[model samples]
Target chain A: GDSVTQTEGLVTLTEGLPVMLNCTYQTIYSNPFLFWYVQHLNESPRLLLKSFTDNKRTEHQGFHATLHKSSSSFHLQKSSAQLSDSALYYCAENAYKVIFGKGTHLHVLP
Target chain B: NAGVIQTPRHKVTGKGQEATLWCEPISGHSAVFWYRQTIVQGLEFLTYFRNQAPIDDSGMPKERFSAQMPNQSHSTLKIQSTQPQDSAVYLCASSLDGDSNERLFFGHGTKLSVL
Candidate 1:
């Protein structure tokens, strides 16, 4: 079985501050594909980025994540937070099934 | 593309009643997925179909729940004897491919509330 873990239930940060959302996963396969999906208020979850190649930095919409198979972690990072960045972030492992994390609620304030 | 379309944006059912949710996947997508979203459980996979066939339904409850994909165009999730705890947003998504790296297009979802 595969699973995903998101440590931050909620993360609060001021605009322009650095932000990081922790995401880790476990799988039996070495080349497991992981994804980051963002869901805004009253909207469906949409893919933000995905990566399977370990150690490669995948970036999209000012956010970046490096899949570290050595640690089984793919931490989402952004140099500066924006007001629109406030949303529920989900980390998912695409194995036999799509195992999604509990999600992290990020609130960016001015 | 209309993306994925879920009928009855909201559904209200009495406890012990039945509820059926409908989902129309993208025109050509072969993979369709159903998930239940709630604050307590987050996103929970219910079942999925590929090429109009039941692929993986291990996530579905043994009793009182069933899913059918009679054709490639539409799928239905039926819950019988619904309970209060069954209240959650039912989401349907479609992907060109089911692999982890493929992009999944999701519907607005049907918010189900059991009275």
Candidate 2:
């Protein structure tokens, strides 16, 4: 069985501040592909970033994440948050079928 | 490309009625997946097909839910005697393959409301 965990249910940040959304996963497979998906209001989920090489950082749309296999973590981070950054973020593990986390709602306030 | 296309942007059905949802995967995509989304369950995997063949359906409800992929272009998910608890957004996604490395492209989804 494979599972993804996002510890924070909600994360609120002021505009221009840093952003960090924690993600972790558990799987029996040695090489697992990790992905970050973002969903805006009234929109479908889209891929933000993905990584298969452990310890290498992959980025997209100003968001970045590193897949640390030793720690089993692939946390999303951004240097500065904008109001548009507010959305639902899901961390997923593509082991057998894609297993998604509960999701973290990011609310960036101006 | 149109990405994935799910018919009936919204579906309202009476309890105990049957509901059939349609999904058209991206052209040439080898894998098609069905998922249920809710506030409680972020994204619950229902089933998936590869090369128009049934693969894994571990998350689907055995009695009331069934999915079929008769061809490469289309797939259908049918719910018999739908319950109120089945109200959620049904999403269809397609990828180059059901493999671990590929990314999924999702449809707008069909919002099912069981009244």
Candidate 3:
């Protein structure tokens, strides 16, 4: 069985503050593929970024994440948080099937 | 591309009634998956089909839930004797294939409300 862990509970920060959403996973596969999906209000989840190669940073929109196989972590980061970035973020491990983490609700306040 | 299409954006059913949700995957996708979303459980995988064949249904409830993919174009998920706790958004997604490298394309889910 595969599992994904993310930052628990709601994360609130000022609009201009740095954004960091922690994620870690456990899987049997040596080369694991991980993904970040974002779901806005009343919208379905959409893929923000995905990575397979270890230690390689994958960027999409204004966010970036690097898969660290040694640590089994893929933390999403951005230079600054935007009000529009407030949403539910999910970290998923794509083994045989996609296993999602309990999402983190990010609230960017102005 | 049309991504994925789910019918009846919303559904309302009595506690003891039955509900059937429909999903139309992308035109050429070989993999179709169903999931239930709720505040408490988050995204829960229900079942999936590959090439019009059932691949993994371990997440489905044995007695009340059933899924079918008679053809490559569409799939259906039927829940019999639905309960109040069965209320949640039902999401359907499709991918080029069922492989790990393929990213899923999700549709606007069907919000099921059981009274």
Q: Pick by DockQ: which candidate is best? A: 2
lDDT of 2 by residue, B1-115 (tens): 9889999999999999999999999999999999999988899999999999998999899999999999999999999999999999999999997888999999999999999
What is the lDDT, from 0 to 100, of the residue A55 in candidate 3? 91
Stretches off by above 4 angstroms in model 2 are: none
lDDT for each residue of candidate 3 in B19-43, tens digit (9 for 90 to 100):
9999999999999999999887778
What's the lDDT for residue A12 in model 1?
Answer: 95
TM-score of chain A of 2: 0.98
RMSD to truth, every model: 0.9, 0.8, 0.9
Q: What is the lDDT of residue B69 in candidate 2?
A: 94
Backbone clashes, each candidate:
0, 0, 0
The B-chain TM-score of model 1 reads 0.97
Retained true contacts (fraction), each candidate: 0.74, 0.82, 0.58
Task: Give the runs in model 1 whose Cα sits over 4 Å from its true position.
Answer: none
Candidate 3, residue B79: the lDDT equals: 95
Of the pair 2 and 3, which is ahead by lDDT? 2
Residue B78 in candidate 2, Cα distance off native in Å: 0.6
Candidate 1 structure quality by residue, lDDT tens digits, B30-96: 9999999988678888898889888899889989999999998999999999999999999999988
How close to the true structure is residue A43 of candidate 2, measured as C-alpha lDDT? 98
